[model samples]
Target: MADKKPEPATKNPKKANLLDHHSIKHILDETVSEIVSSRGYVEDVRLSNVRLLLGTVIIVIALFAQFYKKKFPENRDFLISCIVLYIVFNGLLQLIIYTKEKNAILFTYPPAGSFTSTGLEVSSKLPRFSDIYTLTIASADPKSISANPPVELTKSVTKWFTKDGVLVEGIFWKDVEALVDEYSKEPKKRK
Candidate 1:
């Protein structure tokens, strides 16, 4: 009788390669979504800054009108009207600022020389995030950049954070990586 050998056992029986392909595709999709979402946060910071500045201007104008009315009591009604209009406009601006501040992400402007928040002085232009942290730490106080840093570096860092992850303040790249790993391990736990 001829010796018979058993057929080799298949390493995977459930079309694991296909499953793996699906898994890889899913991971890629999720990663891209997360990156896009985080970028929106950065954009929010820019918008918030603009809102804050405009709100401040409106408030200042309102205060000035109120003071003017108080000083010139001769034209009481006219002065009062100006004050009232300014107050209403200022109130609207404040409302917008409040909404943006609550919903928007915080961004650090880089250090140029030194600045005081209570004073709200921008020396020249805005700083990039990486340089901002470093310069702010080095400076006696936070300040604006003399000129806007090259956009290339800022864009690169933004892209890097989205793809590889970034260590922002206490938010570390390793921490993000661990979170992603945990989420991937148990998709149900995410919800």
Candidate 2:
């Protein structure tokens, strides 16, 4: 009797690759970050800096008054007033910024330098899924508090179903091209 050998198990299965979902999302995020960065859009660091400065100044003054209470009896009232004023000012600033940035285009998505899932969406299906990324780009003017609104552009890109465990399909250069073109255009500044 001739020896019989078992046939090799098939490597390809009908089930969808779940890893593709994460990979696709990651690639999309990286691409979006790169594009936004290329267009010179970056995180608004000045806002954080201003917040830090205000906090430091207020805390130092309060500490100084507390440490010298005996020498300055009036400082207790001064400290109380300072804290109340700071709270009011900080609250107002937060409200204003929040109100301005509450829109879908501004608050949810991360600036160019950060990574976040706010603008990325993945389909629920397992065997087949689509990855869609949406972003709005705008230049942050650090010089003026109320500088004219820089040009704003919203762009979205989608990758269709992943077939046969192979992640090869549409690159969507046209969508990206449109974004690049608009980004290259000179922003309008108010006189």
Candidate 3:
């Protein structure tokens, strides 16, 4: 008599490949959705920088305090655990800050989107992207109060126009330009 072997028991009745595909697809969809929905507009750069700096300090202090505590077994274990937790949780905090920076878009549309940022505001009732103009980057004039980048976006428009020339204390002009370019994209098929 031939020995009988039992068939493999599987929790999921579906094909193994299909289960793998489904889980991967679901995870990707959820991740993409979260990223897309997490749009942020950083109206204040200085405040964000300060908060980031504080987080950095906390992390640094946590790591530095370990030197004295490492001599004891229990204390060192506690410190190690705390530091690990801090690092793990800090990723979430950093993501929030990153999203804010990504969304720090000083808009240029109707209702005159102003972010309280020191940058050019189209004060006139002019249409956006109507004028095919050039960007003339003048030398940066830094303010003393700012600890971050002193880059500012001064509109290369004439004084006759309602172009508010501002010295953005913390807003980097490169970051602004990237957002502006993204926002200014025309739809493939206009509604």
RMSD, every candidate, angstroms? 20.7, 15.5, 23.6
- Show how many residue pairs clash in every candidate, following the order shown: 0, 0, 2
| Model 1 agreement with the true structure over 64-112: per-residue lDDT tens digits | 6666634565767766776777777777767765653332223333322
Tens digits of per-residue lDDT for model 2, 1-191: 02222222335422334446655544444444444444344434454466567667667656765676455565667767767876775775676456534322221233245332122111111122543444444333324333223333332223432454432222433344355445334457699
What are the models' TM-scores?
0.30, 0.37, 0.29
Identify the runs in model 1 with alpha carbons over 4 angstroms from their true place: 1-46, 66-70, 98-100, 107-173, 177-191
Q: Mark the regions of model 2 whose C-alpha exceeds 4 Å error after superposition.
A: 1-33, 40-44, 61-76, 99-134, 138-180, 183-191
**TM-score winner among the candidates?**
2
Report every candidate's CA lDDT. Answer: 0.34, 0.42, 0.35
RMSD of 2: 15.5
Candidate 1's TM-score: 0.30
